[model samples]
Target: MTEIESATTPAAAHRRPASLRDWLAPPIPGSALWGWLGPLFVTLFAGFLRFDRLGVPKAVVFDETYYAKDAWALLKFGWEHKTVKDADSLLIRDGSDAKIWEDGASFVAHPPGGKWMIAIGEAIFGATPFGWRFTAALAGTLSVLILCRVARRMTGSTLLGCAAGLLLAVDGLAFVTSRTALLDVFVMFWVLAGFACLLIDRDRSRRALAEKVEDGVGGSLGPFVMHWWRVAAGVCLGLACAVKWSGIFFIAAFGIMVVLWDAGARRAARVRNPYAGAIGLDALPSFVSLVVVGLLTYLATWAGWIFKPGGWGRGEVAGNPLLRPLEAMPDLWRHHKDILDFHNGLTTAHTYQSWPWDWPILRRPVAFFYTEPRDDCAAARCSREILGIGTPAFWWGATIALIVLVGVWLVRRDWRAGAILLGFMAGWLPWFVPAFGDRTMFLFYATPMLPFMALAVALALGLLIGPARQATVHLARHAPSANRRLLGSAVAGAYLLMVLVNFAYFYPVLAAKIIPYEDWDARIWFNSWI
Candidate 1:
């Protein structure tokens, strides 16, 4: 029987598998074709949304002015270099110029990983708006695909997986970040990838534990699985950290999550003293896989600065006699320290700055771009904008869905619910620490938490939709539970429709399409949004 089929009741979900084969079987077996077809269709839709008018307004929006030039400088010098004054206007006018930089490397605060991603697009498309944003768009597109697959694995339902992807596709914040020249999308991609890898590792490790309860390769110690997937997860997480320092939170949260999953797998496999077994067998390798490997991978992303010449701090560290022996390693450490200091001291006021507490609810969204275009629309006045805000219907619904997932996790011991909560909290809650110091923050930083919010919504929908086969037969269709499921399917479908309508209403501003001033004013739903 499928996992959901076996789960006839909430209590049934907690039951141990009947046999070793049952323990090793796929959860909620689904048609192989729908698995591929559903997610890809949703991904195509997401790609269309992200790529549509990706280069609109023709002006560099918000941080693109910094990142596009940084990418061009990185392409030219293998590291960021200082640009000439009025470079934004110069680049916008003649973006293909290679001589925008002066001598000496620029002291970039963030790591080079995200810039490298931007540099790829610039290499092919030149330093244009389309070029810098190509990576973000591509990453966002793949994020939909990845989230679809992850949800499928978690819920064992293709339709629910597609729903999750569609939610992300319609999310205003995700859509905006994906179409802009920004680092958050890249970091979000890596974080999701790392989590996906660990998820696969969870299944594989469980299968390894199912290899013979009493005697296998490790003999009662839960036979050794290479855990290369976990290692790959580490590499992805490390790459995420390289993209943004905020990515470190996932490394910590996911580390604990994986270890606990290992312990749970042992318990489900009926291993003696499962907690002890996890500590002895799973803990050390997990540390190596997640921590040591992640640290090494993060450091490796600095290859250009380590090997190539003319990077900032290389000359400074190499010149100091006391630190010269260690090369620029000291300078790299000092550079990180300086970056930390800058972040800690960042309390200056800004018009668009938002509190972390308000991010999920989106009380204030950063206005990435805005222009009162002369004669741009049918109306006497028009507003062209790229507002960095999320869809209200989706975000508000997800708030309740997330709360429901928390309750489901506590009441039913659903691992999927707990995992989603952990991912969301890791990306979101850390900002509160900095918030206490009155640190300046923006809504775009909430990008990494969005995928998990989408997942929580999908999981709740899965509960509503129930197993695909439950309502397939006549007697099943007439059953009491079937009636509830029918109602749920209607609700789920209606919610999705609501999400689509909400997205359509806000599409003009989200895509930077010129709109009537009255229409744009209507979209500014809150006073804080203006």
Candidate 2:
């Protein structure tokens, strides 16, 4: 065999299994107790932020007019239904669930999964704002935990993982979404969960392959490794899809991500024909585990509507191709198409509609709730507002970190960096599609990508700290290791503190805290923000 070809081929991989065992071992670092503790601390902080005065504004804010009511309907009725006029005022005025629903069925734009989640809160809290938003807050808080754990696993640093969680917790956009009845936070939660599951799968699958090598199984195609974690990831992605169609992008992105990750793992282990082994041994299993399983889970989320038979679409045993719901009703496919059509043409000029490009910059964040209340403040002009803007420090830092990650991934061939970027792309890049760009979009649509952005920043911090692995990437006669480590630590610490301070300064606007109009105006930061 040619020298280069032999080196590259899996057949030559039979040389020895010693290197593969050490190379494919887990990267998770530190004690299990500390790891759990650090992430849990951040999660508690996230919970506090999300749960504090969740019912504040005490009124239906922005899209809450739809989602909150839909949740109530879903809890009481089996599906979404029309509400009487002035239902918001009536419901808020008396905190009563009486006389809200109209006789007609409501056509919802999104799937019932999110509303069902909201319904869990309403069911517990009796249809009040706090009740309806409860599950969203919980989901948002749990997302912090998931991100922390996932980041820890990826970077093998509990400190960095906690930093990622804290970043997500303190971000104003995440805070506001959690406190209000919104679907984006739930979408973010499921997406983060799916990514976390996949990360675990990656480590486990790689380690299993290493074990196979240690057993002297060579000169053969890659083994069929069990992927329970991957199936769990599929379920998470499916739940994401059930929450919003946008999750389908992650399904596609992550599906491809895992396959590539597997191929790379096999290649690193010097398997014979790594690509073929991955393709032949892994692809079909992945399809069944992630795709088929995910589809089934997504379909299962519609069980409430399916069994009730009063859903917007869905007729007796499915009949005409495109008939109206009032007539020989259509099947789930046509029903779903109606939703797709609504979203495709949803370009009605909303005052707060933002372009996809504006999201990363935090331009034109939607004001979920705003009021110049008559009392309950020290200042003459008091304003209470919940503006859904991200922490500028984290978002902007992450923006730069993404650029840095491209270099890091190319230079180091680090899968973690690539994984972070892939996640951000799966959640954010699809919004730039020309067809969807024409439709009205909002900054909160970027919520599902927040954890990835946080991960990017955390991963950057770890690299900055010049850990041994990173240091080995660039060898120098005298790299001034101590000075560089100190400097890197200082910079990372400063950046995190800046984000924390920024989050505190904007707390009033984020949490609907009543403050002097001038104070709220100062937090706006720019005219575009207003």
Candidate 3:
């Protein structure tokens, strides 16, 4: 035998076989203690990118004028109150009117769940740039950690997981969105976290089902009818929905996905009554846990509105005595009806607004901020400021990768590809329905799904590398050109280096730093980008 085979043969003979439980454990080849290092590195790298120069521009950009002030009001009054236009200037110019805020109601399109998170940051930082944006940056950083953990679990490779996290970190849109004070970042973080929780639940449930089958009570493959993880996933979905109503799509998609998974599991276990057991016993409780529990959690997010008297609609005082119960309801509740009406009626045209069909191509994008600086020697004329659009390479490559992943899943049945596709569908596809109704939306609405897009790219790269041979010795002895494997690794490593370099090149524009007109123009690439 060759040296490699001879060396492995003895170890193979002496090896104590692992139990089936060990096989079912996540493909964490490393010891459990070492596995956490990947996530830690991802978190640190993402944190550095988000927290560096976090207070630059030193003013609220875009929607921060509303959210930052509302967050402060939430801290001071225990609920959000109205603020005047140009509130950012007022808050920044002097400390004289720091505590002066209007007690009237504010009109808004989105829900109040994300506002509470922003309130936490304002409560601590006291309405400064750092205070309002800190939570968004922090959430963005933590999302990298979540992506690492989830990708590792899905692919059974910590290295691949770290790669996915790195891809997300280098994405210009993700970096900018994270650093800016925006509700969409929170929505992204919560949706990703919820999906990660469901993935964990899927693995745990599969292992539980396997154990039940081995115990010979394979009738329904369960001695227990209820599942705790399903309830936990329900709670995560509810929290995600609380952040944004769009989270309902994920809840519904994932709920159905889980039912399908249980059906597949029952069939694999050779149960004759698979459909009945999977649906009747397994699915009913799961539906209640996912849907009903999610509904309750979403309602709980409105507690402040329910309790407060001065909120938007809480002040209707002239209703009939018999209608007191409905009219005397909290101000926030009444405010919600008006907000809902506004959202439904927002069919007006906007210059930067884009259709969902155009979103995939990024045909039109909102300009978050723009400024033309005079007397700038840098460009021989002037400088420009910009903060909209996405990284062309990252988004375009991910777009192609998403298409490839669909084919890969169809032909190979790769579960990881399926999971990424599911997230993309849940986050992106539903926007098309509203777009058909002429709802005005921006490309930033696609921000929440960008991480999953990155994950799809990373997953495709992993597949390109093929299966791991890290623990295999027999194959190495038979293959002649062993050095070629290192070549493949080198190419992948070089590609990753290119991604990091590209991210650095765009960091200035992404952060809204003043750059020469020529430099800014070069980065624009397309007229529509301006």
Each candidate: RMSD to true structure?
3.2, 5.4, 5.3
For model 2, residues 305-364, the per-residue Cα lDDT tens digits are: 665556676534325433333342246778799999998888888888898788888989
lDDT of 1 by residue, 1-530 (tens): 11154332343335544666454545656788889999999999999999888777688899887788888887787778888877877777667565577888887768988989988988988878888889999999999999999988888778888999999999999999999998999999999999999989888777767775635445455655568899999999999999999999999999899879888877766676778878888889999998899989988878777666678877633444554435868778988998899899999999999998998788999999999888646789999888999999899999999999989989877888999999999998999999999999999999999999999999888777665444435324323465666888899999999999999899999888888899999999889999
Off by over 4 Å in 2: 1-19, 93-95, 315-330, 435-437, 468-480
Full-model lDDT for every candidate:
0.84, 0.82, 0.72
Please list the residue runs of candidate 1 whose C-alpha ends up more than 4 Å from where it truly belongs after superposition: 1-3, 6-18, 214-220, 316-326, 468-480
Span of 10 residues, lowest total lDDT, candidate 1: 1-10
Error of 2 at 422 (Å): 0.6
Task: Quote the positional error of residue 282 for candidate 2 in Å.
Answer: 0.7
* Candidate 2 total steric clashes: 3
Number of backbone-clashing residue pairs for each candidate, in the order shown: 0, 3, 2
Global Cα lDDT for candidate 1: 0.84
